[model samples]
Target: MDLNLIALIMGIVEGLTEYLPISSTGHLILVGSWLGFTGETAKIFEVFIQLGSILAIAVLYRHRFYSFLTLAQFQKKGLNLLHIFLGILPAAVLGFVFYDWIKTLFSPYVVVFALLAGAILMIAAQLAKRKVTAESLDQLTYRQAFLIGLFQTLALWPGFSRAGATISGGLLLGASYKTAAEFSFLVAVPIMFGTTGFDLIKNLDVLHPQDFGVFAIGFVTAFVVAMLAVVTFLKVLNRLKLIPFAIYRILLAGVLFYYLYF
Candidate 1:
């Protein structure tokens, strides 16, 4: 029950789930509750550690990010900065507007329903038989990006998952699995940074100097673990697609539901 041990466990959970469409925030909320670590400080800790996962994405896709710097490289690679902006705008605006209200919904009950709902959405997206027009990030259009952003607003619910919503939207809108996953990961960096940064600033009073060590432990652990997870997930996604993850989400939801209400 030591704080450091809790930090390590939560860091592992965050790293493993942050990009997997498995709702890392939901997992953290449930896990924190089980660990008896629920409170203002816990929320800030969760937000802080997410930066580590975001850094993992930024590192893994360094080339793509670097391309954003040069006009010729950006155009040659068909990378559109506008697409990223569009993908982030909808959720960013909504999350900012409802920040306090959303924080209050971070309960096990909300997470359970969200998990099942997101699972259903993922399943529907996979089964819906759509054309695959965008096989790669380069082929994605602005409208598709905007639509994915709109879908991302669903993630305002704790367990719906940012990656799940956006990727499912991409699949529904004619993108290949890889393309959707890639774009989801790409947009996640800025969105998470914005949200986490805002939360830290808003809750600065709750932080203590002693907690920095625990935060650092969680941060480094998430960064290293997420680096491995992101690579492995990308490979597995093409072969297995979203169905397996959807099933996992359903099972997880059922278990959590029973645990909570029984």
Candidate 2:
């Protein structure tokens, strides 16, 4: 496949999976490999293009973030900034500490096992009885936020979805599904931005003159598709169960394992 075509397909995959309980990085790695889009440039492309998806969230939730700039509102709420920082801390710290090691685990076999493990975790989270203590994002306590961050650390593994880990943690801590998903999307802004910025700075030399066209295609594709995915996901979440996603992950893992190992 051509590089531009590969970028478009992977961008679509990233947009669709980024906010879902399925791993975007895992899907990108798998799809990129299958499309022969592997290597340093491809990895950097994947990292940088996540900025586009982050922009989707920024655009969609601009009102919420806008309120943070007002002094009166800031005084009353003290900014969810504190909680958001607490939530992203574990993953940020640990991811940086073990960056190289995590990169090594990005192979197809590791991702296969990770997908299976993550599926089981999601299935278990679905089956577990949840008490709706925190029904809204504002109602979530600091402790819950911290715990959710710890859960997010699980996503350092390729196939362990950040949304999945946080949502499961939120559910286990008695948050409603709506609140859990909302919080997941909100917290992802900082995390994605931080990671992407770090990677971009570290690999600035990886860019070539020809890369901009493909990157722009990916960025736009991800932005448009992510908006659609987020809208549709929130609309149907109340009527849907996480079990189906888990089942889909399991099936995907099995298929990949068969082709890779058989």
Candidate 3:
């Protein structure tokens, strides 16, 4: 297949999955594996292309961010900042500490197992009975914010979706479904940017000139698709539950395992 075609497919997949409770990294790794596109450069390309989805979130939530910056809302702003900070801290610390080890587990076998485990957890979260108290992001307490962030650390394993972990965690912590999804998206902005930015700086020299076009195509495609996905997902959030996504994950894992490992 043409490199450009590969980029297009990947970009579409990334955009569609990045914000969903389905793992974007898991899909990327699995898709790349099947496409025979795995290697150091491919890994770097994946990291760099996530910027597209990050941009979508930034654009979609720009108004909320502007509110956070208002002078009169300084106290609320401070609390918001603290919430975001605490939410991302556990992942930052754990990812930095296990960077190399985490990379090693990016293989198909690990992804398959992680997918199954995460799917089970997602289903369990849906089934668990918990009173919903946090109806909005502003209503989230610091402890709940911190715990949600802690749940995000589970996403270091590729098949464990970041959105899934945080959203499920939010549900377990008494947040409404909409509030959980919104917080998951908000926290993703910083986490994706921070990790992708670091990787880009560290690997900039290794990127090839020929690959720049592919990267651009993937990035643009991801951004456009992600924008559409974000809007659609939000609309359906209240009507749908995580069980469907969890089931999809399990089915995907089963198929991939048989095809790749059998």
Candidate 2, overall lDDT?
Answer: 0.85
- Reference-based TM-score of each model: 0.96, 0.95, 0.95
State the RMSD for candidate 1. 1.3
In candidate 1, what are the lDDT values of residues 88-174, reduced to their tens digit?
999999998998899889888999999999999999999998999999999999899999999999999999999999999999999
Count: clashes, candidate 2: 0
In candidate 3, list every pair of residues with a backbone clash.
none
User: In what order do the candidates fall by lDDT, top score first?
Assistant: 1, 3, 2
> Which stretches of model 3 miss by more than 4 angstroms?
76-79
Kindly indicate the candidate among 2 and 3 with the higher lDDT.
3
Every candidate's lDDT: 0.92, 0.85, 0.89
Q: Report the lDDT tens digits of candidate 2 across residue range 1-262.
A: 7888988998999999999987887788778878999889998999878999999999998987777566665466433777788889999999989988987887778878877888888788778987788888888888888998998998888888888888878888887888888888988898889888988999999999889999999999999999899899988877886778888888888877887877
What would the TM-score be for candidate 1 when compared with the true structure?
0.96
Q: Which numbered prediction scores highest in lDDT against the true structure?
A: 1
lDDT of 3 by residue, 243-262 (tens): 99999999989987887857
